[model samples]
Target: MRSDRDQVGRRIVLAEDGVLLREGLTGLLHRFGHQVVAAVGDTDALQQAVAEHGPDMVITDVRMPPGYTDEGLRAALSVRRVRPGLAVLVLSQYVEQTYAARLLESDGAGLGYLLKDRIGDIEEFAAAVRQVAAGATVVDPEVIRQLLRRRRESSPLERLSPREREVLALMAQGRSNSAIAEALAVSEAAVTKHIGNLFTKLDLPPADTDHRRVLAVLAYLRGG
Candidate 1:
């Protein structure tokens, strides 16, 4: 829907350890009208690909070869250092709040963190690619769940009313005002009021609602 007519096919590099998935995702991206400049199986190859191709986007797995613990995150951080505008989409099978925190700590522009399970909805997932390319941060709902679960062990969130916590959790799930309202049996106006209150208490920057919601979720998890 939001495809850039002038830049419909941005260059991309993919890094994933799973051979089958790596190839499959490359094919999907090609079908969506993007150029797969390079696809590799490990972080080393990822670094090399970035150095050689200078792709506009890097779709990498959170776990990759050579100490598959956080190699992808490390590679992403490295690329951000060299090319701040490069969009990155990180895929993972598990939700790790620490990885999310680290990724968003400095810069969140043109970033996406999604789970492998979400690959089923090809259309929606492709939309996420467009969103990230347009400089939006797309975080998966499961990652938000991890962030909220990590938040409950803190003070401010611990002090929030049960209803407020419910709203906060749903917000982290990337739900829009109307969606959250329907889920909570409230009006859209009521959802907006709760969001305002939450942002005020959390001391988050008043920006676009979606980005502000992301800041709130990140702040909650970081216990700021």
Candidate 2:
């Protein structure tokens, strides 16, 4: 069960330029008990709405009105500068490694980077929102895969057997060794061996053992 602090719904302000997605997300979140304090289509209104509503969270896209380059990202950064604790969940239609890095660089609570395409899974998206609002990090599975793929291309993983690459992909998807084994119809011991081999070839640090998986992917994404 969630603690009282979490059970209470958060006030959310949304900024998505796509009319249908913006409204659809608003409705979904509202159904989940979160308050839709404001929903707008442009950066100016988004910023203004945030100021006026003082929402607990902000769901936005990477691009919005005006230049449409990265207006939403810029707006989120501005919000962070003024209200350091505000939760932000950014939705993007495509992978922008740089944009994801910028949000991660903030080092703030309630940070999220998810693709809008996944909005079809209402429960998953809602869970991400709640996770971020409660001060957890949530990166989209696709983004993680993209980041990992970029890294693997240059690394010695290029030498791994095709089967090993498949195992690594499942691991990159946040699956455990046991789960990967089950999915691949292999033994957990085999999965463990594959992971060790991959780690050794990649020369990733052993420190923060629990987080190194994501870190490894992030490093790859950053072209490390």
Candidate 3:
């Protein structure tokens, strides 16, 4: 729950083909102090809304339009290419790691992938919107689980210890070091060590400090 003290209302453009879900989401976001500038039903309308509103963030369903396959996801990728730093939170009915990984290929900040049916708590959903709007990564836990399972035996991720894997999974979820530490009930120093170990095990050489986590996640997504 957000209080007046730290409330950050974001202007959002919502794209969900289902009329009920789109309206419901708009109302829910409104109740939490977010302004849904536009609620659209298809990829074309979604793109138009983004162009017209220039929202702080975009919340879109995976399947949409006449094809109803991945038009929404593709349009999202396209819009991001044009807008660069625009925040995107993809909501899908199933876990589709391929498209998810493609979306993550760019900067990982302000990116989120979530399953529609899996979001049970309204508060957490709202919090996820806020996080993504503020340039944080927020992936579904189910996505993380299935993503980890796809790693092949020959993959470099096979070298990770169980604890290190846990740290890596949480890292992919965009949890900060302190947040991962608290979630694992360990010291922050322990989480740092686990992250360093994962970096070495994954063969990620020293690079831009801000993007190291994103590189590590890309490695995990590439199943190695």
Candidate 4:
């Protein structure tokens, strides 16, 4: 696990409508050795800054000026479309599964979606930023837990054994098999077996790439 301080000097673009929160985040990033190349309060400004600065990562609120309903998320998607691999970390007051699904439905690399309350844990928040910038997926654990609870009654996930579900949750957290094994106090080979079973039960075909694992996790998140 990389600490917040281990990942420093990243160039960032921030977007938030609230002046105080935006300023506070800017200060925090600066303190953590990241450069806020641009800070904007609206979608258009955000788009412009991303184009101009091409920051290593973007951190934005889910709601922004003009209209507070998902403009920030939409803008983030647009930025991803224009700049394929640009890392994006979204902060929201609420967990909107639809927004999260849309974000993950893309390439699934260099993405993050976390709640605003998580900002209080400055170290965790900073680490998330670093993870996204490093082209890793970082979904909030709450988001995963909520999705699991909501879909438990009717989803294919109900077919999973308890241990398999545990494995799947850790997979959704973007943990590698070794990391998952360490977390679960199991052998790496056991983790691999569990992962294989998860994919088979989820009806995900094997692929040369590990993206099959990502797809399986997404299926679980989507309640299928």
Candidate 5:
């Protein structure tokens, strides 16, 4: 059994339009030893909360406030421009690849784009909270599925073999080497080989300081 308390309490600012879900998520965060400095119901208030609190991370809805189209996402992007490298986790009712692409345009680190209803496990959500706050990228699997369904007519990903592409998609989901192997029912060594191949194909050289695995996924999201 994995524990949800694998990290210290992270300061968070939540932006959700629904009253019930906003309250529910606040309580959920509290259960996992987190502090929600502010929970706003609109884009303007959300930006204000970020500016004032300077929270360690923000969990905001993709749609918020009067317009309720992409206000929350746009605001998140705006806030990131001001506070570069700020950890953000945007929750969405539907999977929108454009939103994913737009969010990852600047930096892929410390980011999360998850569906509202697909977040079924409390422990996993807590883990995602920790991962994003710690500068790791955690993308929802459905988003990856949608990306996979797209025809890679011409892109950097065209160089990758089908297996390498499979490995890359799992990486986008933030899966570990062992987890990827288990998911694919293959050996860890095989997963590593596929990862190396994809990285080479994407021209991402190995760097101890750089998250090449995430960069590969970002490449896929960008134009692959």
Candidate 6:
């Protein structure tokens, strides 16, 4: 793993409704060598900060003031509309399949959704920030597990072989074929074969640019 200093100096805009957490995150970002160009506490202010600063990344809580029902996530989505390809990392206290699905509906590049509990691991949190800024997708493992559990009873994913299911779960964690193979103690060719089979079973079409792995993960989350 690269040190946080390896990806230093990224400009970030942070949005969190809680004052203490916001301050703590701001300090943490600084300690990790990134600049918090703006740190706001509400959806409106968050959008304003992103628009005004045009930060490299936006780190926001899933809920925020003024309804607090996914306002922060909504605001992040809106920012993406205006600034396509902008990196966003949403933090949530719990896994919400709807929220995760909505965020992953399009290309998953430059997107991340993580549990707030991950903040306890500073190195991991910093790594997620760097990954998002570098145009990689990152989703919490627990989020994937929760989504799978919720749809386990009648999910099309049930059609998958155990190894295929394992491959899909690793894909949901944003692992590449090589990484998944290494984790599973299999050859890259085997991992690719499993991924191809899973894509066929899931009925995902190949795209020129969009990642099939991300689409497969989205399909899994949607219970397809």
Q: Each candidate: what lDDT? A: 0.84, 0.84, 0.87, 0.88, 0.86, 0.88
Q: Quick one: best TM-score, which candidate?
A: 1
Q: Write the per-residue lDDT of candidate 3 for residues 1-224, one digit (tens) a residue.
A: 64553378889999999998998999999998999999999999999999999988899999998898889889887888888889999999999988787777876589999889755688789888888888889898988888767745548889999999899888889999999999999999999999899888988887875588998888777763
The candidate maximizing lDDT is 4
Q: Candidate 4 on 1-224: residue-level lDDT in tens?
A: 76654466789999999999999999999998899999999999999999999888899999887979899999999998889999999998998887877788887599999999999999998888888888899999998887767667556687789999999999889999999999999999999999888888887887854888878878878863
For each candidate, give its TM-score against the true structure.
0.68, 0.67, 0.66, 0.67, 0.65, 0.67
* RMSD list, candidates in order: 12.9, 11.7, 13.3, 13.0, 13.9, 13.1
Instruction: Give per-residue CA lDDT, model 6, range 23-44, as digits (tens).
Output: 9999999998899999999989
Q: Which lDDT tens digits does candidate 1 get at residues 1-224?
A: 44454347779999998989989999999998899999899998999999999888898999887788989988988987899889988888888788887887757599888888899899878988878777889899889887977777555656666677778888878888899999999999988888888887776767897788888788666653
Q: List the residue pairs that clash in candidate 2.
A: none
* Candidate 3 residue pairs in backbone clash: none
The TM-score that candidate 6 achieves is 0.67
What is the lDDT for 215 in model 1? 82
Write down the TM-score for model 3.
Answer: 0.66
Error of 3 at 141 (Å): 0.7
Off by over 4 Å in 1: 1-7, 156-224
